[model samples]
Target: MYFSRLTFNPLVSHQQLAQTLLQDTYREHQALWQLFDTDPNAARDFLYRQVLEQGRIKYYVLSEREPVDRSGMWLVDVPKPYDPKLVEGQRLFFTLRANPVVTVATAEGKKLRHDVVMNAKKQMGFDALPPADRLPLQQIVQDSCVPWLQARAESNGFSLEPEWVTVDGYQQHESFAKQQKRPVRYSTVDFQGILTVTDPVRFRTALFSGIGKAKAFGCGLLLVKRV
Candidate 1:
């Protein structure tokens, strides 16, 4: 069960973007380096080849030590070049494939979908990036899809890291509200959702419960748990 934000931006080229964005996010991303197995660069190479190729990467944009932008995606055409000497001994570069969970719903309420979208913010090894506003163009891939990636990671019990090519959670986040340019000021994105299980058998049960019963209503991504 993973959530992902989707988008398309025709601007990306700073090859170092991927390394810059995720460098600081390692703890939350590739946390259990030992417990999860392998050394540092083991996981970094995966993301560099997978996510960055599509110009997609995940991050929690911060401001003054507070999270200002919850999470979002940026899509662009340019690519962040892979650099091994920047940090760990991993070599990184761009690719041309899409990651899962990318969508294209307008702010009004629409669902444009795709299999995999380009990611631009990928780099080899690891290192810290610049501040948000000061973030360079190479670091600005238009389609990020961080939410879905993150959600998938949480459900899988493996954190996201540059080491892995395809991250479980890319765009999943703490909000059901429309993706925003920045985080909400007052009220937060309403995460009130339904934890539902649906299969051929469960659909029979859903048939019994009317739509107005609050059991089955919203038509967003449905997280299905086996238990």
Candidate 2:
């Protein structure tokens, strides 16, 4: 074996040190097992955990699982006093999903633009929203659309009243108003646009005309460029 058992301070609290080492070793074993036994998302998450405080305690190779051949008994080999510890847990079996990345950030199906309202509210954490996740999509639209519409109208020289008693009452009749490029004051709850999902498998079948509520699609976000 290329690795040796790391020496621990015998003079210090031996029980505490042993427990720490054992726990650390167990986590490594469990994490490795999950990479194979669970979904790919679990495997991905397992690899990026925060660094252990006791990273110095080296791992020694334990006996690998071998086929029982003709002898119908599972045999456990004794490793030369190694640090690789055992962990106990029910092995979770989950069927992995298809491409879930498209839901979060994609140009197709208006996902990126549509998700902007949700994403911003998640960041801001408004008191009315209360912990962010509880906010409904409809409320987000109301808060966002009003401001954007007002800004859009003002830029073209039309004045939009904040608290309007009626829907259609802001038409200027003078040349002064005509002199400026006043946008037509028309409001609708509909903003329709199509975004492209580059993935053929995702675009052709799973993602279609409208929104769908489906979870557990094997997906995660990656940023190649440093923000």
Candidate 3:
């Protein structure tokens, strides 16, 4: 596997392209797709997280192959090979932006993935409550999304205490696809904390394969470092 950072080049003079990337998630996905288009029929096999630092747009990407930028708009960092060496009880500081959802069986026996934060709001009748009576958005995010990450950690070969993690940046993204009839929609939550590896093998898999959903639109890349 390889890890790389792609940063927009202000010297490239691509204002329109930058605007499109900033305003349209689907466009950004398509732009990133160009980096890994070794095969026209290849499926997506990478995870990315888009971030803004010092007013510059940047992307952190993990992929099975090195990313090549044919476009001049980005300054692509040299791709570094990644093979995590982990052990049981190893603790690392981590940051993950995930599309956290819970599968629920509908009354009609259909299974649907619902965004945990939105589900919590509905279950608590948040909309019905007056504005003054509503809980702070961050509190609601922490209350709902933390548990979702906790549940994911249990199965992903790591463990985290609620107090050790900070969850926020709840956001819903909506976009239109030219080839699709329905609008695309998803929610993301940011999690940052220290985690202990209970199973190094499993944790390594998670690091490569990602966690949760929406790997295409910059959602499930887990960035970590030694504490």
Candidate 4:
């Protein structure tokens, strides 16, 4: 796999393109798509995360093959040992930006998807009425998203230390896709945790496949480092 960072140009129009990368579901990197033998539209074998640093937009991407690029973007590829073996009981510090959501069957015999933190708040009986005083909803976000992540870890070949897991940078995102008529809405949760690997293969799978939804819109990328 190849890990890369692409820095955006400083122009306003170029910065707008950066925002397009952040919000859009269908990516437009033709060079990245060319890396595949089969149709990239069909394969879709890549993941990415975008962030801002020093007022500049940057993208971190992982793919099965190295990507090609042209002018107007500074690209760097990170080199790593090929197929490094993983073992059980190894510990690592990890960060993930994910869309944590739950699907519920409604009274109309339909299913609705909800942000996990908001769902937690509702389950805690906060939905009947609004709080009179100003409240930091993000605090409730941490409380709600932690257990959801913990449950995911349990089945994904790792276990998180209850005291070590943290959730922050909670925010909602809404966007329109070219293929869809309506807008798509979701919430993003940033999680940082120390995890112990119980199953190496499963852990690797989770690292590549990601943890939750809205991956195409910059959610569900799990980055890890050795402790």
RMSD, every candidate, angstroms: 22.5, 24.2, 1.6, 3.3
What ranges in model 2 sit over 4 Å off?
1-116, 125-133, 165-188, 191-227
Q: Best to worst by TM-score, what's the order?
A: 3, 4, 2, 1
Please give the clash total of every predicted structure, in order. Answer: 56, 4, 0, 0
TM-score of every candidate relative to the true structure: 0.19, 0.20, 0.93, 0.83
At residue 191, candidate 4 shows an lDDT of: 91
lDDT of model 3, residue 40:
50
lDDT of each: 0.27, 0.29, 0.87, 0.73
Pitting candidate 2 against candidate 3, the one with the higher lDDT is 3
Question: What's the distance in Å from true for residue 73, model 3?
Answer: 2.2
Highest TM-score scorer? 3
For model 2, residues 75-131, the per-residue Cα lDDT tens digits are: 222334312221222111111111111135445645442233444465567556656
* Candidate with more favorable, higher lDDT: 1 or 4: 4
lDDT of 1 by residue, 27-125 (tens): 233321222234554432111111233554432110111111122224322233321122222222212122243455668898854333232333311
Per-residue lDDT for 168 in model 2?
Answer: 18
lDDT tens readout by residue for model 3, 1-227: 99999987777766757665766688887778789995657898888998989987789989998988777767899999998889999999999999999898899999999999888888999999999999998898899988888888877899996788999788999867557778789999889999999989889989998998888778878888998
lDDT, model 3: 0.87
**On a 0 to 1 TM-score scale, where does candidate 3 land against the true structure?**
0.93
Candidate 4 lDDT at 82 equals 32
TM-score-wise, the better of 1 and 2 is 2
Q: Rank by lDDT, descending?
A: 3, 4, 2, 1
Q: List the residue pairs that clash in candidate 3.
A: none
